[model samples]
Target: MKRQHVIGMFDSGVGGLTVMKEILEQIPELRIIYLGDTARVPYGNRSKEELIDFGEEIITFLISQGAEAVVVACNTSSANALPDLKKSFDIPLIGTIEPGARLAVSKTSGGKIGLIATEATVRSKAYSSAISRVLSKGVLPEDQGLRESWQQGEQSIALVKSQACPLFVPLVEAGLSKTPEARGIARTYLSGFDTAGVDALILGCTHYPFLAPVIRDILGEQTALIDPAQAMVDELKSVLDKLDEVQEMKAKSTVKETWKLRFYVSGDPELFQSVGNTLLPGLIQEVRQVIWGD
Candidate 1:
């Protein structure tokens, strides 16, 4: 918890760069070490046990790189592996599901929230569970009215509809997110949202943000698209603010602005750089490769 602490974040592929982008914009003073398991991209179909093993290995690599805190930028890993990772790692481990769910609930006027994510995430029902918890707790200011109604002996219920777009990650990674083909797939995957009539739609996968324009056009202006990375970054800032060491350092004068952004991939660095630079132009300067014991 220094003035310029290192934060490690990992995802199955370049998708996590979406989350890292928000962090860079909001907390640029801190160094970031991002690892993308591009060799095993699209964790949508992976088993929970495999995900937990992958999470442990990736997190260990991040810790070796001097990371003081870690962020699970992949929804699949967050849904499946976060609990075990927390038990294994002592640092502050943050995930994307709860923050995104809270934001979706807060913005939802009709009490109907929609979620679009990878197959693994949808299978786990993490978003639905998180949304239910948020509604029950009534922690958000927007839920105050519901809380009051509940206190008056009225039942407050929020409905969640989730759809799994298994191909989204592959499409985005292949640099086809802006293409017509991607739109067609998005239309098919998101058709249910039109019927569900959710006021807010959570872009549950980190990769889905790249398809936001296509999704927005399909869903129209009525539905608000929630990017969990934004909420996750806000939560990260709050966590950083509460650290006594960070506060003490801030109180002292003239903390050097030491921040570095580095990217690592378990797969082909060139492919990762190509897709990453396209998704987030000018943000990716260099990408290095990391190998795991097979």
Candidate 2:
């Protein structure tokens, strides 16, 4: 329970740094350990079974490093593997989907929402399921499944549509967030959702927010865009608060060593150093490469 023991975070690549940045601002006393599977950069295209296996491997590595809790910062992994991973780990596990869904529901006045995420996230239907679970009440017996998909029906919420832009991650990573090519890609990916008349859009992938300016331009100023990072931070604090209270009763106070942040990658460390440092700001002081699947 030591504050300096480190809170572990994992992403397929750099995306999770967004969540890490927020956590540092909110809980400045805690140390952090971040690992980016940069060698396997995008988990969005992998099979569900593979993602589950990879998630377990990363969690094991983090726990071995004395992680107090873990944030599965990849949307694809959160959608496909979080449940299984949670069962395997005693530490509290948090994901991005629920918070994003909560934000979408809270921000949309029209009840018409759009989600843009990786192919794996869109295929898993996590966002729709979370939203539907919240809106599922008062359903007539006959109208049960007809009003929305079973997942959404469970939550009693309906999304006008969902789209997958698998290429967005690569584009963002390549520093194309404000480039002409990024704009073109955004225009192509967003045209369908825009035409569907959704009042708000959920930037479902953590990496998508890096492209927010272009995405906003493509979707127009009136459409509300929700970034789940803030919501996820809020959720993390709530869970940590409860855990802190329990630890207090058990007399397990946080250690007072100088907090440190560590970074690891499966690929070349130098490749990620600059971008990673930029994303994490003052949190990361060094980057080390580790052999993955070892």
| Number of the top TM-score candidate | 1
lDDT of 1 by residue, 1-294 (tens): 343677899999988989998988888777899999998888999999999999999999999998778999999999988988899988889999899988887777566788899889999998888887976776443656754664576644455688999999999989999999999999999888878777789998999999999999999998989999988998888777766465586685544544488899999999889989999998888899999898
Error of 2 at 56 (Å): 0.3
Tens digit of lDDT per residue, candidate 2, span 207-281?
888888888887788898988888888877777777777777988765576646788888777767766655445
* Global lDDT of model 2: 0.79
Worst 10 residues of 2 by lDDT: 137-146
Question: How high is the CA lDDT of each candidate model?
Answer: 0.86, 0.79
Clashing pairs in 2: 132-155, 132-156, 133-155, 134-155, 135-155, 135-156, 136-155, 136-156
